[model samples]
Target: MSAVIRLLLRRLGISVIVLIGVSMLIFAIARVIPGDPARIALGPNAKAEQIASLRAQMHLDESLPVQYGHFLADLSRGDLGISLYTNRPVTKDIAQFLPATLELVFCAGIIMIMLGLPLGILAARYRGRWPDHLIRVLSLVTVSAPGFVWAVILMLLFAFYLPLFPIAGRLNDSFDIARVTGFLTIDTLLAGDFAAFTDALHHLVLPAIALSLSGIGQAARLTRANMVETYNKPYIEMAQAYGFFPSRIARIYAFKPSLIPSLTIIGLDFAAMLGNAFLVEAVFAWPGLSRYGVAVILRKDLNAIMGTVLIIAITFLIVNIIVDLLIAFLNPRIRHSARGSA
Candidate 1:
């Protein structure tokens, strides 16, 4: 098999193992935690027969292994059980809120790549100069504060004081667009409603920037550090001796070699941003999975909590796998080494 195929299979195998382990751990924790889930979900007035039936459906009478098997079975069918907090299926609730969270994260990731990386490259290109110093200082300031703090600051400056953007919610309530895929941005565009799309994007700007600021700082710093090191390599010296344009060397030679390490961290940052979205979402009054997750945890909604945690865990694994594949594609050494091992 080709190295790429082998690498993909290897990552897939590892991700499966990790996901199974996470499921087992989360399943065990959800079960052992203090309250009777079925009773809680059903309510105090629920009949004894109802509670028994619910427990049976959850495989509560079975052994731990059997219960786990049933959990996996239900998961395979996207059945996460009824959520006590929402009085809806956990799966259904996630479907409603998850897209908003994903859209926010996706925009943040774009900001990280488009803004952060180029700033890092610029800083490295003009090391010891004013631009480098300015960018470095800005990055430190950005990273010093958490996402929620940034969210509040952004809301104050852009939404309240300056009144440049909306302070809360995904869109102006006036635009009555149907939820085709639950993503307002795409749904509006699909409906060919430019006004709603513009409004949705405007509302998204502050939250996405708030969430991405820290990631951007990290990406910038890591890229600068990596590229600075890359600059010292003999290859870079050779490129300089050849009288290659500074921009060309920075773009082609230094950046690509340094990107592998930076990409790994970016993947981690992107995954972590999802968890970090809780406070930012709260600050923005954004309706997303993070908000739902907090609600579920506060109520000690067992199935909802497990379902949310499991979904986040799965997202992490998937992002990591994609990053690994990207890294393997970028660095031939990895693919060759994997092929050799195989």
Candidate 2:
């Protein structure tokens, strides 16, 4: 228990340090981008005096270190400055949009685990049989392309020709679901609108599938490869000799051991989905943070860009921490080893 607490504290402290690096890196990148943000925000007809004023307001005339000092000071107060794109505070803009992306990514992560693991297990169980071959081929095909390409393909097939799923958006406009959580499905459920919840889910399916396809494929391949290797180990051969059910051995003995390493890659893929969600969101018209981030970056909204990227960085670190805790939990030796080293 103490080891777990220590691990959490250590990870949190490391996350903070990483976030500071991320802030400085993003700040430098934003600063170096060609073109004055003030000119871009004000547009072509802006007077020189107006541009100077805006730059001053942005602290652009100050030295980089001093500008960064003020930026950090504002950040400490939870002030992300104003978004030139939305004319709102960046934090408010993120609050409005972040949950949608999180919901979408969460749904995709679920798909990856639920679908990928089983397929992998089945493939490993079958070895060189047709099921294994089929799954391998399918995974290869799915992973060959990026999420947005899948989004376009799936949208065209199901949304246009077959019309099984709606083409885009989080919910039908006819359903007046409250924006309680910014996650339409949860919000609708909270509102006791089963009909709206179903509609929201209906809208979520295509985009989630689009975002998850690559991850699903990657997970399936990794799980199958690892489990296959696990099967050849001495314990697996002993389990086979002991008359243990092949199914039981495969599920319990093989899968559990292989899962530790798989968890790290899977977690990374899950985090990667946040970045990948941008194109899929654009395709689906999903009004997520990804869309807002793209908008701010194009407009050179430095404050908004930094805020969005920082939020994403924090989310990424949080996911990694969760994966670490999960790994530590699953294998108690991690805790023991930490306590040992400490």
Candidate 3:
């Protein structure tokens, strides 16, 4: 009955409706693409009878509406059907590669947050100074460059020229960690192999940093702008008058409030990295969903494409929802509504 609860329910309802609409759109678009899923599956040298049988198996013989209905029904049961390219269950294929992408994204996110926020705060606090100008220029350059550009430059500098890191892939041949979770870092730790975990971390470092650079720049700029505004507020002035340490006032009063807006946008950028991860993966030859997505799209694999698109959409939606919830918690208007009901 609380306003906070009501708001949450409303957001959840909207998200569900949006997801349904997205799925329907994806399903329609996939079918409408100018390609024969059956023929693609059977390859270029398929016999007539084989193509016919494959089409029948894929239910390409069914009417469009009927096929869409079947797709929706299967989706309700957590099945995205089968991939024509891999000839595996769509969900299984996604599961196989999704974790790798997720791992990269996760590490990238951590790097972005660890580096971006402090830099932003520092730049904002030091506004009109050399440090601020330097950070602004750096953030501008970083934001302008694409992830793939960073990936290549990083590879050329670190892998080829300096030979500081491995050129491609998730792990070295020497690692003997069990693939329990399919995440090399976690699997190595689970196997109690510190050496392998260290090696995996080293492999992950460059790619994660490359993926995160743009996000870090964007976050820094957003945070810096917001924090600059927040620093000029009456509360900030009052805190300064009260002899509050500049550091404490900047962090506790200015930075925290400014972060609400920055976090929301940053969450969206992080979600976007899921799609961008493809370029990074391709450059590194990492076996992530991004590479899988590119491959399946080229092959015109409808089910695989659908599954990948749907997953990315859901990830984006989920990130937005989390951002909303975080903002609601931080903003007194929403939090007080919940507190009042309690």
lDDT (Cα atoms) of all candidates against the true structure: 0.91, 0.94, 0.87
- List runs of model 2 lying over 4 Å from the truth: 338-342
What's each prediction's TM-score? 0.93, 0.97, 0.95
- Considering lDDT, which of the candidate structures 1 and 3 is the better prediction for this target? 1
lDDT of 1: 0.91
**Model 2: what TM-score?**
0.97
Clash totals, every prediction: 0, 0, 0
> Model 3's lDDT to the true fold?
0.87
Top-scoring candidate (TM-score): 2
Reference-based lDDT, residue 237, model 3: 92
Maximum-lDDT candidate: 2
Off by over 4 Å in 1: 44-53, 335-342
List model 1 lDDT by residue over 1-342, tens digit each.
277888788888988898888888888887787888778778899999999998887778789898887777888897987888998999999899999998998899899889999999999999999999999999999999999999999999999999999999999999999889999999999999999999999999999999999989999999999999999999999999999999999998999999999999999999999988888999999999988999887777877888898888888988898998899889979868745444
| Cα misplacement distance, residue 325 of candidate 1 (Å) | 1.4
lDDT of 2 at 30: 91
TM-score pick, better of 1 and 3: 3
Residue pairs in candidate 2 whose N, alpha carbon or C atoms collide under 3 angstroms: none
The C-alpha RMSD of each candidate to the native structure, in angstroms, is 2.4, 1.7, 1.9
